[model samples]
Target: MKATFGIKERLKSKKEIELLFSEGKSIAKYPIRLIYREATTEKNFTIQTAVSVSKRNFKKAPDRNRIKRLLRESYRKNKYLVSKNTTHHFTFMFLYTGNKMPDSIIVESKIKEILQKFISKEIEKQ
Candidate 1:
């Protein structure tokens, strides 16, 4: 199993997401929108994750950070599974579209479930 998500595991910039969206395909399961594009590189993938809590929900940075942290941690732990299923590498973005910040445990569970579905989708794609 891989040990790290590394620099490439991150969905660091907007251009990456834009490129994927313009050319790549997407799958959404509410609160989680997954945009993925095949990459030419081997055993290399990039992921950008986000959670949405508008001014109406979280009025503070800390509140927002708390949610983002959970999402990231959850992804970091389970990313290797997604990483291994690639015949071709992929760049993926997990967007949080929920209206408010739920419990961290719930968010973590949701992230894992979402990732599992993503792996399942990849199998179907094959």
Candidate 2:
């Protein structure tokens, strides 16, 4: 609700990440992909999330870090869409699948689209 991305909201545990990947469902919008699963967390947070950029696409650490930063920023701004609508807790991973360097506008717009799609899919599942 504070629009802050804090430590408790980060997906960091090795076990949790493994479980999410093993049982998660994924949605993709061109250069970005979302992998998510319903999960109960030890913390009070409703959603725990992580972002990744493929090392293969960006050979330089700075490039990958930059893209990851963009992904996190986009998600942070739009996280309320999922938080406000969902009754269940979830773990999420956003993967960057594109090779080119991205602009913030493009990343933000795509993140909105991707989250909309995810929300729609969740509705359909209900």
Candidate 3:
């Protein structure tokens, strides 16, 4: 698989987003929280994902956008960890919960850790 974040990998449907929040299970690895559930739709990809940064943490739009960008970049690069060896399709929402701005390296490492945790947990369930 190519190391690319395509549009198809984005979670855009309002109903799906609602379902994800309402029915998903969450795993938090500090700074980042992941909410995920098995996809209801028969999509092609292994996962579709969205990202969020709390307005309460950063009141400015630029600050939130920057953090979101870092989250996306990290996930885009490391998402293969979740996709590989998984037969299930999932929808994921990644939320930033830290009060202060974090470096991209911190976000990336945390994301890698969380994704690995997610994969391990899912494997055990199978």
Candidate 4:
């Protein structure tokens, strides 16, 4: 698959977001946290994802947006790990928990690590 995060792969429904946070399980690797839950949706994609940066941590709109961008790009590049390993549909929220600014390399590595952990956890469940 192409390394793209298109509109269809985005999670935008309020009800779905609420359900995801309420019922999802999470895995964390330091500054990056992945909150995910199995979802039953009519969409064609295998996963729908959103990225968030805590306002409390960044304290500036530009800072938050930058981190969110980094998180999304990293996930966009590495999300094949999820698509290839699992058959279930899921909603994911990637939350940035650190207080300092992050570089692309750090974000990408952490995103890959967290995604790998998520895949391994799912395999164990099966």
Per-residue C-alpha lDDT of model 2 across residues 18-54, encoded as one tens digit per residue: 9988999999988999999889655589899999988
Q: How many clashing pairs per prediction, in order?
A: 2, 0, 0, 0
Residue 99's C-alpha lDDT in candidate 2?
93
Question: lDDT by residue for model 3 over 8-48, one digit each (tens)?
Answer: 99999999999999999999999899999999778978899
Q: After superposition, how far is residue 76 of candidate 4 from its true place, in Å?
A: 0.4
Off by over 4 Å in 4: none
Residue 106 in candidate 4, Cα distance off native in Å? 0.6
Better of 2 and 4 by TM-score: 4
Poorest 10 consecutive residues of model 2 by lDDT?
37-46
Identify the runs in model 3 with alpha carbons over 4 angstroms from their true place: none
Off by over 4 Å in 2: none
Candidate 2: Cα lDDT at 73: 90
- Candidate 3 TM-score versus the reference: 0.97
lDDT of each: 0.67, 0.91, 0.94, 0.94
Error of 4 at 5 (Å): 0.4
Q: Write the per-residue lDDT of candidate 1 for residues 1-126, one digit (tens) a residue.
A: 665556656666677567877997777666656667775455444444433344555678887777677767777787777767765667776666677766767766777787788889889878
Error of 2 at 60 (Å): 0.7
Quote the positional error of residue 16 for candidate 2 in Å: 1.1
Give model 4's clash tally.
Answer: 0
For model 4, how does the per-residue alpha-carbon lDDT over 1-126 read when each residue is reduced to its tens digit?
989999999999999999989999999999999999999865699999999888877888999999989999999999999999999999999999999999999999999999999999999999
